[model samples]
Target: DHHLNPCYVCNSTGHNCRALPRMRPRIPDDVSPTEITGNGLSETEPPVLEEEMEEPIGVEDTDFVLYVSAVETERCRRGLTVAYASHCQQESALDRPVAGHANFCPGELSTKYRDLPSVLSTVKHEMLHALGFSVSLFAFYRDDNGEPLTERRPDTGNPPLDEELQIHKWSSRVVKNITRKNWMIRGGFMERTFHMIVTPRVVKEVRNHFNCSTLEGAELEDQGGDGTALTHWEKRVFENEAMTGTHTQNSVFSRISFAMM
Candidate 1:
């Protein structure tokens, strides 16, 4: 079954099939901060308030809007895969992890897609998966006392070093760009499965090959010449102190996920 492992691309419908139309991207319009509570407006009241209300006003006019996805859906229909919409919802999904499959299925699409914003996000998420850029596991690092390091605020002196941070930083960017859409799947056994598969390799590489102890003393070589690599003590510390924590599962996946991020 290893050879039979199905990727997301297996579901391509051929020539006779019609493509799924892309949904619109949600947009906002100029609306007063005061929300309208009226179920219906009177014909008599509208004319007098027209001068006071915002221009382009009408009885049925809405301030809500839908934008970008129409363009993407068209591209999908034409069999063109676009990668990396910078404004995509991948970051948002990372902030709020969810159970992917349980909440999302083709059958539930009808109800979910009724909400324009959700529809666009949902489509973009699936497209990311189809392209193989979805995040399987995401985590940051912590200090010796189990406090999460602030990657954002580097101004707070120095930060703890862990191989996971390096791998996560490198892999996250590569994975994000690999897809034309954004990733939405979060915190599930699927995420854990992916972590289990790749993390051990990362751990092994950090443990055996990357030398942190000699990083500082290792002289840097000329750019054109074969440069000497710097000694990195953090790598050794990570292996000895970070990796040896008391956990039932000593696997890299367990360590990283359970790290005090």
Candidate 2:
């Protein structure tokens, strides 16, 4: 479904895959590097890591992160979807011209939300999505040579959620190491699913606080429709988080989102 689409990964990085600058922005000193413990750590840790708990609101790294979704995203391929998170995952500063692409459903945005606050808010939401917040398409990020990017090692220091949504811990090796080269649902959902962001709190907030869904339990998304497999949070989680499948008045950008970029 992804072939020479309007990809943002290369645009944002300026085709840096051939030679990524050594002086990319460093992680801010205020944010601590992820700590390792005796937990079942491995080299397949997720690309994005935020706080131990909670999907913090409104954090972003604009350098390597950007937006583009004018293509075959999982949901509403040619619909009014706004944008998708897309970026390259080069193996190192000196790799071939490989580019990984991520896209969201296409949609005609409404004029009502075009004001500065609303526009910027929406951009914040999409930017975080590009950074891999609560997003599952990270499995497709590839190097310039069309090969899957390498995953970091020693999975460690993530907060825990229910079995269905274990954001902190990877459930399998495939999701951790495998790439979606030819297919989407590959390797027990480790690649097809987002194992970094958990929506338990958001789900609860939606179910209890915002009155979103009727179904109970920690099923992040409903049965499955319109490419809902691993691209979005349960529609009701956190009552319209920026990364949810649907957008609403309650949308709020997450802080944990910023760290992932």
lDDT of each: 0.27, 0.40
**Could you tell me the lDDT of residue 146 within candidate 1?**
38
Candidate 1 lDDT tens digits, 1-261: 111112222132211333232222222243332432353233333311211112322224432121223233433332223221211111121232211221233333345444655445445434333222222222332334534323432432222234443322323311111121333456532221111212332333433444443221211111221111111112223332212221122223223222212
RMSD to true structure for each model, in Å = 21.2, 19.8
How many Å off is the CA of 26 in candidate 2? 40
Error of 2 at 219 (Å): 5.9
Report the lDDT tens digits of candidate 2 across residue range 1-261.
122222223343123333222221233344334532233223344233332322223223323423355554455444555554433432243322234444543354435645546555656665554455433444333343544443433331112223454222333321222233344344643333332232334334435543457523222444344434455555644456555666667567543233223
Model 2's TM-score against the true structure: 0.37
**Of the candidates shown, which would achieve the greatest TM-score relative to the real structure?**
2
